[model samples]
Target: MKKLLMFVCLSGFAGFPSTAVAAPVVVGLADGLAGNRFPWSTTGGMRWQQVFSAAELTGFVGQNLDQIAYQTVQGATGYTISSLVISVSTSNNAPGSLSSIFANNIGSDNTVVFNQANVTVGANSSSGGFDFALPFTTPFLYTGGDLLIDVLAGGSSSAATFFRANGSAVTTERVYSSQGSPGDAGGTATSNGTLVTQLNFTAAGAPELHPGGAVLPLTFAALSCLIFSRRRRISY
Candidate 1:
């Protein structure tokens, strides 16, 4: 009877689920610095409209992407960020055009969309810039080697907001500018040799188990059955 009870206790303890703790992951062109250049959208007047930036993640595939944070500079007139689109592709080359990124399935297979209802920024004169967190409705799983982050701002207005660019510069990634309207995808060129934007994101590290879920209940049930059987045997 004592051995049976010990066995039951050991089984119950072993079946307990472990706590799942995910680690944070950040990917960007460079660390933000003071007095960084603010790159604005191209569609709005003199300022550029859409800036397409790409980066290669060092982590393995299948990591859960949680939130994306980018540095921005507010202009005289407050601007609203319309949406943020993230696409993953195997190819390292830049997409032919912004519109083509969505339509083409050649390299990009996974696309996550985040629509901004009122992601606005107030005017700020500070050169340190402001970091904005744009959380995804659902976490996206990393599938490809390269990530293309497309930020759309100035929804239906000429008012401008600027995204801070990498001052230290990066060679692996390039920034593309579109002179025409959003989704136009025409007359695109590399704006700077190594002037990529500063951005970061959080991703899940290792997976963990939990208690009181499916496994725990089954373990308790088996343990109860074993205890009951042992009790009956001892009584007889």
Candidate 2:
């Protein structure tokens, strides 16, 4: 009987059959994000349509979303992605796919290469809408700087309807007509119109901070406490 008691007590000190503890730490999250559509200040019929661009990003300060809010808690950048409303004012113009929306990494050649996941578009001038949270094939990080969202016309026109980029030194450049070559393919509109948007990035989360990770150190601490208690009892 005494030997069995010793074994039981030894097991407890060995940190086996651990006790489950309640977790009470609640962390806040970032605001949900949605793309905003703004009308160009100028609207008129010209030989080549003039691309309207969003104003230079005046603020890195973020706006609020009703459905979901984006926040930074415990160093992790929280994202609340959802559907967004959009609109295009041109006669036959419309909002296209977001597949092209990606992280443009500056290359060694001093150019940009956008890397991201495939995307789809279904919104129109009448009732603009978009679905966010499509799985990202190439999720890029925005350390800081300009980010452009270009709307391209499918082989339909040599000119682009619009093009927009957001970040510091925000400037809206609209080209009503194509300067020359057909320009790159895809949804990026050469002259459709572009809007300048603004954004700021928070630090990304580290692997160690994930949940279920606090156990290791906590277990060690608990084991130490138990050993101390056993030693005191033995001394007595």
Candidate 3:
């Protein structure tokens, strides 16, 4: 019993069982060529939805989804979004299959992660990098499976944001509107294109503070161990 107690105490001290804070993690296609931009202000389009298969987003299972990041192409230096709403959800579909109907392709947990005005997106010096981001207002708890990204914006930029593409793997699908300020659900489905994008997530129930935050993990671990040792000594 005493040995077991010590083991348990030490485990806490050593940050066992994944209780430590989960660092912000990103998952997506590696850097690649320009794909396309959203609500291209130049054409007056308003909304878009990017779909990614469960195979691509499997890493997000059991995590709290927080941010959706975009990359800019080499041609344009900056992209400005006047009013934007970013939403995300999940689905259960094969990597190569997608329906032209937006409603036919999503789960019920669609969440508006970001809604802001007048946001400026910066450019990547090279082909494209995950530099533009919309920090979610509330982290979406991803239960696992396919992921969907819905974007609606009321702004414009001369340059475009590109995504990494895999012509061989049709794991991503997209839908967007060509008219200005289309309703959230109004958009024409386009040919399949795997977008190179980045998504960030936070682990749920993490007890440790961020690196510089007030309480350190070791502090609690040491205190717990000390208390346990003292109790054992008294019983003896």
Residue pairs in collision within model 3: 35-162, 35-163, 164-196
Which sections of candidate 1 miss by over 4 Å? Answer: 1-26, 30-56, 74-78, 82-106, 122-130, 152-158, 172-180, 191-236
Q: State each model's CA lDDT, in order.
A: 0.46, 0.26, 0.63
In candidate 1, what are the lDDT values of residues 1-236, reduced to their tens digit? 66776687677667655544444444444544423222233343112222232344555455666555555554444655444344433444443332334233224454444555546554554664335555666565666455555444334243444555544434333333343344543323332332333333334543344354567676667778777877878897
How well does candidate 3 match the true structure in TM-score terms?
A: 0.69
* The 10-residue segment with the lowest total lDDT in model 1: 44-53
Error of 1 at 81 (Å): 2.9
- Candidates 2 and 3, the one with greater TM-score: 3
* TM-score top scorer: 3
Better of 1 and 3 by lDDT: 3
Error (Å) of candidate 2 at residue 207 is 3.7
Model 1 residue 234 lDDT? 82
As for TM-score, the candidate ahead, 1 or 3, is 3
Task: For candidate 3, write residues 75-117 as lDDT tens digits.
Answer: 4656676677777888554344556556666679988888888
Highest lDDT: give the candidate number.
3
